[model samples]
Target: MPPGPERFVGRERELRELRADIDTPSLDALRGRPAATCRVLLVAGRPGSGRTALALRLAREQAARYPEGLLYAALTDPQGEPRAAREVAAQLLRGLGREADDDPEAALREALRERRVLLVLDDAASGEQVAPLLPHGETALVVATSRGPLAGVADVRPCTLGGLQSAACVELLAQAIGSTRVTCDPRAAETLAERCGGSPAALRLMAGWLADRPGMSVTDAVRVLPDDDATPLERAFGVVAAQLPGPAARLMRMLVLAPGALVDAHLASALAGCALEAARDALEDFARYGLLRRDPGPGAGTEPAAYRVAGWAVPLLRDALEAGERAEEVRLARARMLERTVRLVRACAASAAAPDEAATDEVPLALRFADREAASGWLRRRLPELLGAARIAVADGELDTLARRLASAAVLALDAHGQAAPERYELHGLLLEVAERRGPDRERAAALINLGDLDAAAGRTKDAVARYRAALDAARAGRDAFTLGRALEALGDSHLELGDRERAADWYGRALAQRGERGELADAARLHTRLALLHTDDGRRDAALREWRAAAAAYRRLRDHAGYAATLAEVALAQEVSGAAEESLRTGQEALRWARQADDARLQRVVLLGMARVLERLGDTEGARLQREAADGLAGPGDARDS
Candidate 1:
């Protein structure tokens, strides 16, 4: 019987516990109970820990107890969705004698009562999800392998699995390559086993990998293991990547750059820089040969399975991603990934909703669940990768679309993670050189504009003004209206910082007129808000109020709450300056509400402080003190500049 297939790596304790549970008569009676009863056995372990191997071994070894048949199914939910319970039940029933058209759950329960089968559910995701398909019948046995705890099943025997012992790991490697070769260099074999953390899937992957590479010593393979202790799977991945063909090697690198390890044929083709047919063939070959793990994509319907380098292979995969490719290519690939990553981060950074894709070239990775916590977590984990890409792009003098896009991504990423001040001010400095080199005109202007904005935020008014002038000249030479508008607004803001209200108003007016003529409502709204502030500084309260109202209207049309609240706050300031005490109180209250609604605590504090000054001027000492206290409370702990 081939010993029902070697359980092949480790978890002796888990096997013993499972054996004990199976032998227990009370548990057996529950499983064998009349219709409407079921027993579920969950085998939980990390990826590559041999959960599936163990489950299969246990199921086959106990086959004599299940005289009816052995039924197996893989539950791979489509991307962006959970697998349908009904669909899983239907597949289970069809594996037996039931028809596909029959009510799945009902038919499943019926079939379970009819036979004593060994059911193996492979790659199960969770407990609640797999529990429904459990069978009732004394002679039947159910084995499920998953990444997490399964819930709510009677007489449940939970088997927690782990990697192999050193000896088993070495034996696995020996069986994979040659026992004599591995045994000859026990030290090298021990190193490989330790590097793989005794993971059977890892061991198997390494076996296949080493089998192909005659020149590579087991010690050489261990050297490339990912440095992170928590990700042993990736260390094994690095070993596998060093063994792939050119196309497969490139494919592995590109796949790691993808978000969530998911990619379709279209994306895979783009990544490989090849035709879809070739990409599909390569993907199939990879899966067939076990170089990659395949799972059906979310909402894939009947589409081909999406592939990822096995978890054990991630380290190898990332090493491949970082290796061989010229520094320039690696930088560009990272730039692309960050372009997508930053878009996602920016979308989540907002206190309100995401913007439309058509309005901007950068679009966010939309979340079906709208989970802020999850989005934030993804950004934090990938921060190093994104930062490395930005640094690489700036270092390589290849300032093309890729470089510019990378700079934008870097800026947004910094902002999203709240690292805009001192931590990322250096990024702005790096981008300046790339922009200056990449541009004959438009690129130069855009880069200068961004540099000016960064400088202004850092309180370098003089440097900001200089960069804005350079941007303005480049914008005029290139005849780029948007660039010119941005430069004009930036220059105007710099002037305002120097208390040059007249110059600020003039620049803001020009920007407002140009953006208005261009029908760029969003840009026009921003310019109008700046003009409102300049007018207020110039003591023209009525003009400031008018500009703010118009700005707010424009921002509202564009669904830009950040811009709207800023303009509204200016209007409140105008009311206060014009000595309209009652109106100032009402407008200030409204402005504060809008600022909070916009989810910008920094802007909210600024507005509250302004309101405090207004209340003091109007002789409401109590109200003034309360507003000041509230603003101070909000400004607690963090850098006052971060918000």
Candidate 2:
């Protein structure tokens, strides 16, 4: 369930309305049978208006009615990216003690059809995301909370929440401080509440400010608060921020300029140029003072908590960051953030590809990871922050080097993790703008290559080919051999996708020759794999097998288990096609072992399915059946095959 309302104040009427909707039987249920339609209750409100708290409270109240389960899913990351629907479905399936099957949505719908589940989807980006996750059964209810009305969703009971009532605001203040303190100055309490504009978040922050000073009277508190053109929430934030010591206050301002919504102590340390311990202390103090909110760490307290600037306080903080003397400070802080972010991303990419003993010495101690999984997890959590910081750097102009490096590192990390998304393309476009304006030739080449990759992924082959050609020109101008090779390879891929076999082969051959001359084994291996695919597509099985073998050898030398496993699977398939059943089965088993060692479930499933087909061809029916079952078990709810 979402966190309980902290000193939850008014909204009795809204609560009653929510209760009535949940308690009353649906029209279909009233007709003596349940219907295949979900009842959606949308609780919409402004930021800091307590929408999440109200929705969670309603979910808690109706928990008993949903005996099968109460499932809560946050539909967006802190940076406001809408999570993929398949990922959300997997979470729901896990909560229900079920593994994700191929077709997670169908699996979830089936489960909901047989059970009474109440889903509370918080911070949804749009109605489209909510629509796919809705339970199509009368026995289930969905309470969706968003900053907007979710306007286009059909059959929703929309409740748009505003600030608290005057009396409730005072009551909330009293609860935070004490009844005695508030009642001692009832009129002053009411005045303060009015000044806060009845926003529970603002009121609570003000209450914390007052509660910190034992002898500060309510009148005095109201007197010290800012009265300006800013909104009540902003003024309230200003009032609280004023009380913080210099370090805390400065950190608060810098945080507003921090990329994305949340920050860890390591990032804070980088921004502050202070020790990690000091940054952590300042962050904790901000949380205590109600200027920040602490998010629970990953699983079972293994990690330290992360902090986010309270939503209501952000505008005021940003205002402070941009005002007069703080502008330079904000710029410097963002530069530091960009440098550190670039290093972290590079470290993650290196760690994911292959561990480097010397690389550890180069990475900051705070950014070093235990293994690939840890590095990947950190990259996933901070992707939006890294992208946001890169944009800030690009716009700022002074940090062009850091910006270029950050963009390059981010692209590498995203590629390594197979997490390329449309947002990344947008970020690459921003990088391209920066490159065209003031970046070095090498940076310009890198940006063009990254943009080309995005265009190819989006199926804009012509656009990708154009970008790659531009990249090749930049690379040649800069005399950057590595980027030259990369651009050629990318161009080859674009032409391949466009069915221009001759052009594709010419580009691939040039890229391969360049990589081989440079002793860039990884790039050479990837090129060989691509060439093998082209060969196989053209029915040149012998040539394809030769290329796959070379690629596998290079991958093994690099200790790239995932790549080697994939190449081995292709080899197995080729062997099977050539009537070498025993050799095919042997290679398939070896591929499966490597996939397991790499902990890549997708690769494991691919190998298993391939093995199953080979086994079937070899007339081993029982073995084939077992392999197919194993493959099915490893398939995720969102597997492309299911789609």
Candidate 3:
């Protein structure tokens, strides 16, 4: 679950009642019920009334009961528009590791059926929008926060929220500025809370108004604080907006236009076209004014504070400075930021020790890192925002070139990390959409292949094969041999995983033909190894030996000792299984030599054990014993995995 706001007060009774409701026995545990309606709890409130914060806090508190883990989905985009049910369900399916980007409602239901996951659907628009997305099981809990009533969204308990208690509101104010100011004038604090209508958001703005003007007392602020036909939140907003410094106000307006969940000093600088330090100062001002919340995560500080645009202040920012007034400035700023992201992503990808051809391009010196570890850390740290930026680019459909570049680079940087499954699904899905819409043929082919690779990793072999086949068509349309070969190789891998060795062999053969025509030693080694494995599985002795020898020769040409050793080890095993003990022993000895040269102790130990078996078969019992002893001595305590 997402972190709730700091200094949350009140809502205690509502929480208790809702907790009881969630724990209460559901009337619809069995399937074929009216969807997930009974399993849901809708928390409804007006804007700035703490609806989202309350829902998040409750979700976190109740997380442990739902062993399947908690899922948080913001039903609205950053712009506050209600996203389509299809889009929301697709993201939910992706988050659940079920990749169905198009028409994902049924898949989402299938994913949530019988799963005890807690789903927090935040900022829902109405009943019609939320109705289609409820979970299908009583064991699963759905906590939906909405500004609207969501009248028929669910047949569950409803928690209607209002302003905080006056005392709670005063305590909230005291927490922000010091207790001394409120305690210094008790009557005025009560009046201030009442005047702000006990809304946390408005009170926070008032606190900022007073905090920024330290010399002014609570009484003085109250004297000038507008009390008009406008809502208290709006009146408080009027005071803050009227007093904001030029830079801070400008930064706030552009920030709503800034894509993603964060706005750092560098991003602020880009958006405002100001110096970094100046942007930092303005961000500090925004934080103090409660226009942005200081992120409580790691690396929190003034020089590099990551501020989340306060959800309540979004409309205020738009009202203060409409996006249309300075549309070009926002566009240029976003473009500049996107360009920087492309270079940064490329540089990180290039940091891999054996970078492939596409990711080896030169970038700005500043973007380059000292080592692979540092590059990986940099890339992973910024991956979320980088991906968010790509989504925005696609939604906006303007920065096609930069968005496509970011697609490949982002996937490259993330593909190696197994824990990045969610991001991989999201990025590839977005890339596939973008590529199909307007991207060049090469990008389209690459996107399909990458998505297919993800599906293959997830054990969706049939789906992967479908995507790989599409990628082949795209690659052929572009006449790009590299992507075509890649598609063939991926298809081979998926078929192999599916236990269709014949089809796998065919795909590998096609891929090898292309690789030999256009690529290098590495591709040859890989294809030969794949073919050798397939042949070995089929018990084709001569064919397996020929492919293994070819693989070893390719590896030797490339001077890859590790690959050569592994291939030789395979050859020894095949010989041993085929009753050629003496030849097997010789091959194992050669493999052990190359394994030692490669400094791969595990590979060496494996060869030693295989040689031991060969020695025993040859009636050399003492030699077998010695080889076993050597292999055992090389094994670490934790290295008990099957060789």
lDDT of 1: 0.65
Candidate with the greatest lDDT versus the true structure: 2
TM-score rank order: 3, 2, 1
The per-model lDDT (C-alpha) reads: 0.65, 0.79, 0.78
TM-score of each: 0.42, 0.66, 0.69
Model 2 is weakest, by summed lDDT over 10 consecutive residues, at 294-303
**Candidate 1: count of backbone clashes, pairs at least 3 residues apart or interchain:** 12
Model 3: per-residue Cα lDDT over 556-641, one tens digit each = 98999999999999999988988888999899999999999999988888999899889989999999899988898889787763
Error of 1 at 108 (Å): 1.2
Instruction: Give the per-residue Cα lDDT of candidate 2 at 328.
Output: 72
Give the least accurate 10-residue stretch of model 3, judged by summed lDDT. 296-305
Please give the RMSD to the true structure for each candidate, in Å: 19.1, 10.0, 7.2
Which pairs clash in model 2?
none
Better of 1 and 2 by lDDT: 2
lDDT of each residue in 1-643, candidate 2, tens digit only: 5356557778999998887876566666777876656888989887778887798888888888889888877777544468777767766775675655546777888888857889999878898888878788677889998888775666678788988998898888788788998889999998888887778777777887887788888898789877778777778777877777777677777887677557777678778788878988887767655667655333101226677666556667767767623567777787887776776777777677665444666765556666778766666655555767787788787887787778778877878866643347767787788878976898789878888877776678899899999999999999999889989988898888888987998899899999999989899998999899898999889988999999999999999999999999999998989889899999999999999999999999999888888888889999998998888888997775421
